[model samples]
Target chain A: MFNLFDLGKIFEISSRSVKYVFILFIIVLTIGLTESLFLSPEDYKQSHSVRIMYVHVPAAWMALGIFAVIAFLSFGTFIFKNKNFSLISKSLAPSGFIFNIIALITGSIWGKPTWGTWWAWDARITSMLILALFYLMYLLSWRIITNKNSANKISSLIAIVGAINLPIIKFSVNWWNTLHQGPSLKIMGDTTIHSSMIIPLAIMTAAFALFSLLIFLMKFNTEMIRIKSKGLDRL
Target chain B: MVKKVKLRIAFLLALILSIILSLFLILQSLEKDVVFFLSPTDIKNLEEIEKKKIRVGGMVKDKSVSINSNKINFIVTDFKNEINVSYSGSVPNLFSENKGVVAEGFLQDRSYFKAVKILAKHDENYMPPEVKEALGDK
Candidate 1:
């Protein structure tokens, strides 16, 4: 089982790739941390506590990003009937749900200090919660349906329908008056954030992307190995 | 083969379109949903305050809580300082006296808060950190 690839060659290649990606991840994390923690001045309104935005904002961004990827994967599986695409998408669901959970938790934590409450039914918050729920339902759909074709078809439909929530989540605050504050980094007529803050945020966002990529790749590889092993066992 | 190709192309197109649309929406929402957390003390010092929306956090002072139908009145205190909060809405499961609470709304005439929403602490130990920092200790 372990003798499929040249051991030394595989080790050398994997280690090299891992090192490069890890270094890049570190650099992005450092920039994000430095900008958010040190370089960016305290908000005129929120002061130092506003720094939590660095973490909260990126997590929220990645949550949606991962969902979008999953939705696409689901679509691919539905159209092409590719088992690999479905497996990859299914693998991503748990991670996407985890990120969504993190985003909601961090948002609530940030809300406690800023909004004075832990949660609100404000459009954005409510919609994000719905997004998380949808991800969970998609994951559960796989468990309930043993037939691969049926499971893929149903979950793909769920993913597509749930995609509706993404737009609602984005525009919720604007459509209705909400307690959640408007954008800080970008604005229509004016930008309130300092350059120092933006730099770190960009870095952190990149770091988060890398981190997510690493996780997805590892999960994909593990699934591939499992499938291969099962095939070998049948032989 | 043609049918499969069409499906693949359609899926790819949908994927690209949805991704672009989602990114646009995420960017747009960030403009409004992102904001800073504030303590009760910070809410007090504003001179030109009007209908600006904000959040307030503190422990619900014991015995100061009053309920009349759907309307509820509670005093949030940081042991040394306190603010009166009046809210009329569906309360969360964790709201109670001697626990941390955060109310969202605007200050009315520099004295009372006309809260449109309220959030209760989910646990015993989890007060908003900003509240703890503002209150100094405990």
Candidate 2:
């Protein structure tokens, strides 16, 4: 008598929190999209295609951001011997991997029009590829290890080691001259970007963050439920 | 217990340091110059035309295409209008007549696109973004 409808109870627990998050997500998205799309004047150079930045850059940011979170969770599990932290890390893997893939794909698509090439082995590109590989390895490690305790120990170590790649990815462009262009949104001294452009970018970033959080929450809840139901069935 | 606590503190410190470092790098990248791609129509409307290296994209109009030794000549069509394009470098696999392409460089004397590089689609099914934009206009 496993009814899929029973899943609705999961939604009921934090319904208020979800609603508030959703509202905030929508507001952020609206502001970001409007600023980037309508209000921001087209680049004196790029024109309309510059709009793709609203999507491409934020996704790239999140791809890196999620991995950072994963590293922290992995470290916590390793140091504190916390199963909950390990579960959170495991839950985040597939989504983080998917985001990185999306970022690379969109980046390639954007690069074709802008860089005149679909693929490049530049520092940023190469490091991001490595990050994607780390994600795959993390997932594979989870699958291969059958013993729960041993798997947790090994995976935690792997996650910590893989975190080294994050710093390399972040500094790749600066460390080496590469085809991949540097950041254009947030700078230190001189930001020539108009408020119109910045606003949409901010909105899109917020939307991306909310979307990631929503997915994480949903996935975490489902995993918990599955574990609980399996235990009940055993009883 | 004290050793474990110290290790946990160290880990947390490392995490915070990494995040701040990433933020700094991203901010640094934002300061670097960014280039843009443009089509012929965009060039016509642009005010500061001389300063930027813009990408001109369209199709190589049939019959307007010519070749001499190393240089190639052709007219890029936007369906409703067209512009002359000339390039001296190796063309991409997708360069052909009536097919979409993007040329990177600058306009010479407001007449011909003196392309420094040429990019072409790899397959028949693919359309360049500039072409898609133009097609969307109609």
TM-scores of all candidate predictions against the true structure: 0.60, 0.60
DockQ of each: 0.06, 0.05
Off by over 4 Å in 1: A1-19, A185-190, A232-235, B1-138
TM-score of chain A of 1: 0.84
* Model 2: reference contacts kept, as a fraction: 0.04
User: Against the hidden true structure, what lDDT does model 2 obtain?
Assistant: 0.69
lDDT tens digits, residue span A33-125, model 2: 777778766653345666777787788788888888888888777776767677678877776787788889887877676556888555688
The worst-scoring run of ten residues by lDDT in candidate 1 chain A lies at A1-10
lDDT of 1 by residue, A46-107 (tens): 45667787787788888888888888877666676655567667767776787788889988
Docking class of 1: incorrect
Residues B37-114 of candidate 1 have per-residue lDDT tens digits of: 345565566566667787676778999989999999998876766788899977765577886676878887555887
Fnat, model by model in order, equals: 0.04, 0.04
